[model samples]
Target: MSAFPEFIPSKLSFHLDSRLVTAVAVAAALYYALYRLQKVKIHPNEPPIVASKIPFVGPLVGMVLDGGRHVKSIGLLNRDKPIFTLPVPGSRIYVVTDPALAAAVQRASKELSWTPLIPELTKRVMGLDADTVGVVAQNLDPEPDEPHGFLADLHDMVYAYLGPGESLNALSLAAARELGRQITAHAAQLEQQSETVDLLAWVQHFVTIGTAQYLYGPENPLARDPRLEQAFWDFDHGLGRLLLGFAPSLVARKPYRAREALVAGLEEYLSAGRHEVGAAPIVQRRIEIAHLHGFSVAATARSELSFLFAGIVNTATSTFWTVLQVCARPALLAAVRAELAAVVEETATGERRLSMEALKGACPTLHAVFLECLRVGSDSYTSRLVKNDMLLAGQWHLKAGSVVQIAGGVLHADPGIWGADADAFDPARFIRLGEGKVLPAAFRPFGGGKTLCPGRHFATHEILAFVAMIVLTFDLEAVHSDENISVPPKEDRVLPVHILEPRTDVFVKVRVRDARAVVVV
Candidate 1:
């Protein structure tokens, strides 16, 4: 069946003759091969060149198939090279390996840009209409009439909502409280009898509900469907394909269905006046931004779904990884719990609660564990479209219109930057932050420069809050007879948007912690 509806035509009414098509295809193939055959030369100011065996399409295909793995394969092979150029047909992409070069790339935004990619992403991933795309383009104008216009660049507007300060804190706090509340309720239910559950699955639901509750407010749409949490995971599983303009309806059918169902639910939720309730500043601003840009309610709802995806999907995965990293190591887990002991309070009625303020100030070990998890599990890649030819680091000449990629995993594992244990999970990694050993660019799990993740602060708070509830409130053990804590194999991981999540959900036997287990500071 065709991906488009029955009303749509399968092909244009007019077509070139078969013989002409054959001739054109042959010419294009010859052109591509010749393009590959041309003796490639790298100038002194240009980075070393690495050519894929398949000419124009090899690098793109490999990246599409296994993003992080492909990057690692190249990054590891060229340990001595701070950077390299991958030439694909019409484009030249510079991949940064060294932290110092990465910093230079971050500052070279004028020559290497991010604006053009945003509209392209929206059109493909969000399936936005041409008119809406125009609005996004206008907002992205670097010099708009109003410097702080609500309808400023899409990135800026999004940053406005998620940027640090009171607005972000309020949204984050609300989400943390809701997640904690739900986890406590779930714990209460499990306390009646010893129960088994998929550990990752439960945390996914908890974070999903908590995030949805805070973002969409009391009239949360995910609450309307029992299967939405799973549905979202299904869609997320195929996200890279969908984002690459693969016809998701045909290639990722289940994910497409899941996305459409969620979109419909979100549309209905807004129609029922649900967005009016629990509307935080971010949500309120998003709605206003869309309205001001001439999007209909349905279009606005669809746009919000993308933001909601950013808010919930990757975040839940990050939370799961953080917990798994901690739980997988007993010494680390004990240390983390002990760090929390200073801020954990047991009430007269035997209820235990974490003081967020105290944890923020006192829980250095937990913070270190969180940072280490991000470094070890991050798959985030930053891209910039080169606008003008320029020399990078006064050495490598970057070509105009080429795409530059800064792979977080590469920087995270840099030996000189992160030390001998760069590839190992060192929970106390960030404890040495003040020692001036690690470069500022060495630990950019949330990315850096203007394109830094606005949700970084919020995500950090929520993950810590959720994990605190679990470790402080429950005793957890893997249910499988042969298992203790089996982390998902690194080889099995696909390049996902956030930290890699286990391919299979982790099941555990859980019981409320005994009073003695709760450390009273």
Candidate 2:
């Protein structure tokens, strides 16, 4: 007692004790709440068989990582079922597998609307303003009610710049001749080298040049400018980020220096103001109409770039796959070549080249080949969110705001619709149609109804022409005789990303074919 000091009380001890008690209570309450949530069975709205126990953000995180492998795996597991539900960020997604159910979802676009995920992504990568981007415009209160706001205006401008009609007149006989010359020049260089090149890359360059020439005319220096080439490369490089669903605001925050260079090149072309007297055909007429409708030329030009991006990328991918498949399959390849030879021989007038009609008639096999490739390698899908509570597949009453997806990959490979060898690549599958043989609802590669790709015809023509030229000029053979070719593994984090993704790297050695070697029937 003599050595001990007098005991002292401190206000800090009392404060610390109270705070500690409050923290523990809050933590305990959170734990109890989470435990209860885990115990609670999913509502009848969610199918019992579907896996939905993933915490918080759910399976979306995993789906984003690797092209929805978990979703696809679950789809295979539950193939017999009509519908299943899985958790996604902020909501649960119902995946519709039954053909009828998918049709219902696709048809109900007015009641169930598509979310413009990709368009939003495009806005970000293009480095446009939030208002120009149109994301969350509905929520901004006091939004403009004009019949044609930014998006509609942009669409009209793009249509004027590159859509079908007189607008495409500049892209006529002379343009075609120039294109042919350019293609031949490039092909000759390739033939001389005898080196295996990535056909898709070369085709992309060709399409870009052809598209620019059509939009800006031959006189515009940007049409032949080397600097424009670098800008396009930069624009393409930034595209991968958009496909990954990185925040548009973030991508927009950084100046797209390369894209700016492209825009600058375009400005120089616009400044020239040199119009070919008789050149204002369909394309020029459309531009006049656009101007009359109060469309801004600058806006039209910006929108045209978007058109160029969309027009070429998927078409190039499709063409690549079509050529690769034809070259790799020996019997199919031989049959196509034989068909072409017969057509050319029948129509050949010793002096003039094959007419458009003759070329069209000569390539039915080529069309069939293209269709088969589209069936197997189409990278598009349809999605919608429910607007009202509805029972789907005679089970699972999905509430309003729930998202639904129709799995195109699964549908394309469906054994019931396509036969036992659905997984195998067979061009013959599309060549003949039996009487009253119904195409399965699952056969939607261009999507269905209103949302179907509008440029389908243009794309088909482009692919056929490119394929015809390649097959006509070269004898194609696989570099590795025993190599197996298949679709590249799906990377689906970003919807619609599959359209331009390569399925596999195929090496084809091309040798110049004699004009008489293959008859173009």
Clashes of 2: 14
Q: Which residue ranges in model 1 land beyond 4 Å of their true spot? A: 1-39, 42-44, 139-141, 144-154, 157-161, 433-437, 480-483, 491-493, 503-505, 514-521
lDDT of each: 0.74, 0.58
lDDT of each residue in 1-521, candidate 1, tens digit only: 66766435424322345657888999899877766653274456778877676666667788877766786678778878888887776887788878888888888876777776777787767667787777666634365464533235456767876777777777767877777677667667776476787877777788777788888887777888867777777877777767777776897687778877777888888788788887676787788777776787777877888888888876777777777778777888898888877677777876666666666668888877777778887756778888888888888888888888887777877777777988787776678754467776666777877677888878887777877777877777778646777777443236646777666667777778743222112
Cα deviation of 70, candidate 2, in Å: 5.1
Candidate 2 stretches with Cα past 4 Å from truth are: 1-49, 68-70, 115-119, 134-179, 187-193, 219-222, 227-240, 243-260, 267-301, 345-362, 387-396, 432-441, 480-495, 498-500, 514-521
1-521 per-residue lDDT for model 2 (tens digits):
64343322345666788889999999888766754454333575565436444543446666555454456566767888777766554566777767877777766655666644434554555544454455323322122474553444433444454455553333433344444556566655665555565656656667667655654567543454766765675566456554444653366322366666665565455445542423224335544544554445553345446655665567766777787788767677778777766655433543113333445555677777887787777645577767777766555677677777777766776787778888877777776643235344576666765355555655665566666666766776656646633335433444453354464455566666633222211
Instruction: Pick out the ten consecutive residues of candidate 1 with the lowest summed lDDT.
Output: 7-16
